[model samples]
Every structure is written in C-alpha cells, then in structure tokens.
Target chain A: AQSVTQLDSQVPVFEEAPVELRCNYSSSVSVYLFWYVQYPNQGLQLLLKYLSGSTLVKGINGFEAEFNKSQTSFHLRKPSVHISDTAEYFCAVSEWHSGAGSYQLTFGKGTKLSVIP
Target chain B: DAGVTQSPTHLIKTRGQQVTLRCSPKSGHDTVSWYQQALGQGPQFIFQYYEEEERQRGNFPDRFSGHQFPNYSSELNVNALLLGDSALYLCASSLRYYEQYFGPGTRLTVT
Candidate 1:
C-alpha cells in the first residue's frame, strides 16, 4: 500500500541548464527509492537507486538524487542537461513483502523532461 | 548481457479478444514481474513470478493470469480484453533481493 507522487508533470530546461524533478512517497514501512529514464518508445533505464546508504545517490548521465526521509522526498537533480536528456523520467518506490519474500515497485505519474536547444 | 526482452513489439486486438504477451528475463535472473503502463502514466505492477510460481500480485483481476517456464521465461495472458486494457505491457527481471531490469514492452492496442 505504498504510493509515489511526482509534484511536476512536465519540466522544460534549456541545454546546459540545471534541472530538478521532485518526488514524494507515502509508505507505512521503510522503502527503497529509484529513478528511471525512458526515451521515446523505449523501455526504462535505471538512473539511480537508494537502498540504504548515503542520502545523495549519483546516477548515470550526471544525474543525482537525495533521499530526505523526514520530508519523504527523493528529488532528482542534474547540474546540466543536454538535448539528448529530453525524456520521461519516473520515480519509483519499493518495499519488501514478507509474504512474497520479494519487492514490487510503485511508480509515480512520471515527469516529462524536455531539454530545449 | 541481454537485458529483459518482450515479444511482439506491438499488437492490435479487438475488444473481447484475448491476448498473450511473452517475456525473457535477463541472464542469471530468476524472477520476473509484469506491469501495465497506460499512456502518460507510470507502469503499474501486475504480478511477480519466482521459482515458476506466482509470488505476488497487484490489484488486477483474475482475468489477468501468468505462467513461468523452467527456463525462467514468462507469459502474461489477459482474457476478454477491454478497451482499458490497451496499454504497454512491460516485463521486468531481477535477481533475488536485487534491482529489477526492464524490457522494451509489448504494446497491446484494443480497438
């Protein structure tokens, strides 16, 4: 019964500009967080994950996200964006299920990032 | 190594028809999960398979079922499909207690 909320549905950033995508989750138990990127007509590629370590998690393509437990937020940030970074990004949460002995991801509505040239 | 893969990149079906989607998990992975992604929305988990059995399932109805083979490949079958069933079906694979990798997905279009 975990859920994720992405504050923004669309984000537009100019080439070489910094951008951030906000995500928040609600869960009764501890959880893992992740960010994934999807190009047009392609499957999702894992950007980064927060299992249980540093709050700042770095990912591919110079993207990073910080896990804020108190705020229940895991916001993705990129110092600079490229035209190729224009894609849909998703924030997901995973929680262990004792009955199944596995974990399932619950994703947000998604934030479409558009990098303008 | 090959990541997760799904069959029939796209399929078109009429309402009330049945559809079957296939998936091959990544190498060395023993678990597979199916998800449904509607247009402009995130993917929703359908179910998970491990050791050739269903381990977890989401809020989907019994009309949605799945099977896993000995080779760790999986199949998702939806009976009496409705227009709302038209969406991208994604298959994800993972090692025990590990992160999951995704497939390109099978687009099911119901007209």
Candidate 2:
C-alpha cells in the first residue's frame, strides 16, 4: 500500500514570506504526485501534479513543488504567500492500476498553512 | 466545464438511520470516486465506480455501498450510520489514469 506523510501539521508565516510544506511517500512502484488546497468548508482544488516530466512542477496560485525520486519527497513551495493562502494543503500520490485501468490517490494528513497579514 | 458536483450540501441523520449522497462527474469524465474526510484529517478513499460497476474499494465496511449510472453519475449510500460516519463526503471525477476533479463535499452529521 502507498502512504503519504506530511511533516508539519501547521505552518504560520507572515504575508509575502516564503513557505514550504514537506511531503514524503512510500510506494513499491512509480507513482504520480499531486498537491491540493482546500478552503474552509470547500472542496479541494488541484494545485499541481507530477506525472512524468521535470522534477520541478508549478501549480496554481503561484505555488510549486519539486519531485525528488531519491528522497521519495514531493515538497510544496511558495515564494511569497498571501493571507488568502490560509487553508489546508494535502499531498497525494497515485499509481496506475493495470487491472482497474485507473489511478487511486492516497493522501497525507494535511498541512494547515496560515498566512498572517 | 462545471467540474464535479454533489447534491444536498448538508445532511443530518440519527444513528442506525441511512443516508444517500449524490454526485455528477465532471464533463467528459467517466469515473467517479468517493472519499470521506473527517475533522482535521485528510480524505480517505471509500470506493471507485467505472462503467456502472465498482472497480476499486478501500478498507471500509460493507455497510457502505454505492451505485453508478450509465451517465457517469454516482451515489453513496451509508446504512446503519454511526457517529464515526459524520464527515465530509467528497466526490471526484476523472478519466481513467488521469487526475481527478473534486466536488464541493456533502457534510454528513450522524447524531
């Protein structure tokens, strides 16, 4: 089974400051990586994804993540965050299932990014 | 497109009762997956529906069941609800082996 681990449960940062949310996963085979953000009482929105490409992946809302195969990490980063960025962020991993012909996402506990003004 | 959509934004039910949640996949999507998100936790996969049949499922109990329509819409039915079942039910839609788009979840409260 594949599982994701988020190091920080909550991160507090001032507006315009840079932020990083660490994520690591354990899987026996290659997997696709994704980042999602959820506002209060709202559905999750995709931030970005790493299917097969360069290690660096950019997402919506000026966010980005680097996929490190050696470390089994896909850390999300934002150079400058706004107060509106305050939300719960989740890191998910998915791998193709040949029998099902679909990809199932396994998510992390989530990181609360609180950007203070 | 309009993205994935769920019906009955909120629902409250008593213990041992049953509840049904509905979802319509995003335009051009043919697969629907259901997830449960508890307070302060991430979403847990419940099951996946493809071609009107259950394709994948997680470690949930048999009391949890679902159905998929030919139009690619889906429904999640929870029988004999428990307080543990109180959570946000999220529905996601996608093409096979592709990224999924989420819908605003249905908040289910079991008393």
Candidate 3:
C-alpha cells in the first residue's frame, strides 16, 4: 500500500509570485506519482505525472514538479502564477502493482491554492 | 471523441433511499473506476470494473456496489443511502496500464 502526504492544506500567494506545493509518498515498492488540479465544480485534470525519467516534469499552465527519489517527494513549482491558477491540488501515488489485481491511485487530502491580487 | 461522461449532474435523495449513477467511458477506454469525493477532501477510490466484471474494490461496505456493461459503461448503486453519502461521485476511464481520465462527476445530495 502507498499513501500520499501534502504538507500544506492551504496556500495563499500573490499573483505573479512563485509557489511550491510539497508532497511526499510512503511506499516500499516502486511507485508512480501524479499531480491533479480541480476547479470549483469541475473534475480533476492531470497536471503532470512521473512514471520514469528525469527528476523534473513539466505540466500545463506553466506548472512543473520534481521527483526526488531519495526524499520520497514530488513537489510542484511554478515561477509565476495567475489568478486563474487558483484551485485545489491533489498529490497521488500508486504501486506498480496492487494486490487487488488492479492499479489504483491513493491520493492526499488536497491543498487549496488561493491567488491574491 | 467524447471524454468520460456521467449522468444526472445533480441528484437529491432522501436517507434510506437508493440511487444509481451512470458513467460512459471515453472512447477506446476499457476500464472504468469509481470514486467518492467529500467536501474539502480528495477523492476516495470506490471500485473498478473491467471487461464487464468487477476487477477491483475498495474499503467501502457492501452497500456500495457497481456493474459494468459489455460496452464498458458502468453504474454505481447505493442501497439505503445515508446523509454521509452526500458528495461528488466521480467516474474515471482508463486503458490497461494507462493513466486515468476523469469525468465531471455526479453531485449526490442525501437529505
């Protein structure tokens, strides 16, 4: 089993400021990491995923996340944010194989990102 | 092609009543998974269906069950619903060993 922890429940940042949302996962086996964003009343959209590759992964809306194997972390960062970037972000993790005979993702509670003007 | 689609964007049900939500997967997708999202929380895995059989289940009780059709559509049925069931129910579609694509979800209100 794998679990995701997002340290920040809420993040408030000014427009055009850089921001980082921290995430950590616990899994003894190989894992896949993902970041998703949700606006009010909308379904989740995959921002980016770390299957296997370099530590840094770029996503839409100028967002990027770096996977740290040693730290068991995948933190999302952006040089600048727009007001429209305000939304809830979730960090997710999954084992390469689940005993239940399926590949399922376990998610963090969520972090609310509020962009202040 | 259309993405995953869920029916009855909004639903209201009284306690002890039953409710069924439907989902149509994205084209070319063969697996459908269900999740429950409470207010201010991330979505929780409910179950998954593949090839018209229940391929996986979560920690939820038996009151929460689902079915998958041969066409790869799915339905989540809740028996004797409770007020705690009020939340957003999301349906996601995926291929074998592929990342999931989620639908807008059905907002179920158990009054």
Candidate 4:
C-alpha cells in the first residue's frame, strides 16, 4: 500500500514570488511520483512526473520538483508565480501491482495555492 | 485529438437513488480508470477497465460498479447511493502503464 501526505492545506503567496509545496509518501515498493494542478470545477492536469533517473524534474508553467529518496519527499517549487497559478495542487504516488498487471495512484489531500496579485 | 470527455457535467440524486456517469477515452487510448473526488480532498480510485474487463478495483464497495464497451467508452454506476457518494466523478484514460489524461468530471450531489 502507498499513501501521500501534503504538508500544507493552503498556501498564500504574492504574484511573482517563489513558492514551495511539500509532499511526502510511504510505500512498501518502488513508486512513481507526480504533481497535478486543478483549477476550480475542473479535473486534474498533470504538471510533471518522476518515474526514474532524475532527482530534479521540471514541468510546465515553470514548476519543478525534487525527489529525495532518503526523506520520502517530493516537494514542488516555482521561482515565480502568476495570479493564474492559483489552483489546488495535488501530489500523488503510483505503485505497480504485478499481480493485477496494473498501477494504482494514491493521492494526497491537495494544497490550495492562492497567488495574490 | 479530442481529450477525455464525460457526460451530464452535473447531477443531483437522493440518498437511495442510483446514478450512472459516462466517459469517453482520449483517441488511441485503451484503458479507463474511474476516481471519486470529494469536496476538499484528492481523488480516490474506484476501478480500472481494459479490454472491456475490470482489470483492477480500489477499496470502494460493491455498490460502485463499472462497464467498458468495445469502443473504450465507459460508465460508472452507483447503486443504493448514500449522501457520502456525492462527489466529482473523474475518468482518466491512458495506454497501459502510461500517463493518464483526465476529463472535466461529473459533479454528483446527493441530497
């Protein structure tokens, strides 16, 4: 089983200011990490994913995240924020089940980022 | 190409009523997964379908069921619904073991 924890419930930041959202996960097996952003009344949009090879992954909209295996953390960061960046951000972990021949995603409760203008 | 699509953008049901939500996968995708997102929470996986068969299921009860047709379109059916069943129903499609694309989602309200 796998679970994710998003340390912050809500983060308020001014426009053009840097921001970070913390995430941690626990799993019995190897996993993949992902970040998704959700605008109000919409489904999630994948910002980036960390399958393997790199500890630092960059994504669309100037977003990036680093995977720290020792700490079990994958925190999202952006150097600057725009008002449009206001949205609910989710951190998720995916584990493959050989028995089921599939993968399942476990998500955190989500962090609402409010970028003030 | 068209992304994932879901029907009846919003729905309202009574505690004992049943609801069926629909989804169409993105072009060229063969797998469909269903998730339920409650207010102020992340999405919880319900089940996944491939080749018209249920390939995997989550912790949800039997009251939650699904079907995938030959065209890869799918439906999520909830029987004997409760107030807690109200949520945003999300449908995601992808190739096996690939990145999944999500739909706009159907907002279900159980009153």
Model 2 segments beyond 4 Å from truth? none
lDDT of 4 by residue, A7-109 (tens): 9999999999999999999998999999999999999999999999989999999999999999999999999999999999999999998888999988999
Q: List, residue by residue over A1-117, the lDDT tens digit for candidate 2.
A: 799999999999999999999999999899999999999999999999999979999999999999999999999999999999999999999977777767789999999999999
Report the C-alpha lDDT of model 3 over B5-97, residue by residue, as the tens digit.
999899999999999999999999999999999999999999989888887788899999999999999999999999999999999999966
lDDT of 1 by residue, A1-117 (tens): 899999999999999999999999999899999999989999999999999989999999999999999999999999999999999999999998998988989999999999999
* lDDT over C-alpha atoms for residue B30 of model 2: 91
True contacts kept of 1: 0.92
Which wins on lDDT, candidate 2 or candidate 3?
A: 2
Worst 10 residues of 3 chain A by lDDT: A94-103
Give the per-residue lDDT of model 3 (tens digit) for A58-96: 999999999999999999999999999999999998675
- Alpha carbon lDDT of residue B66, candidate 1? 100
Interface RMSD of each: 0.7, 0.9, 1.0, 0.6
Indicate the docking level reached by candidate 2: high
- Among residues 3 or more apart in sequence or in different chains, the pairs in candidate 3 whose N, CA or C atoms overlap within 3 Å are none
Worst 10 residues of 2 chain B by lDDT: B92-101
Candidate 4 segments whose C-alpha is farther than 4 A from its true place: none
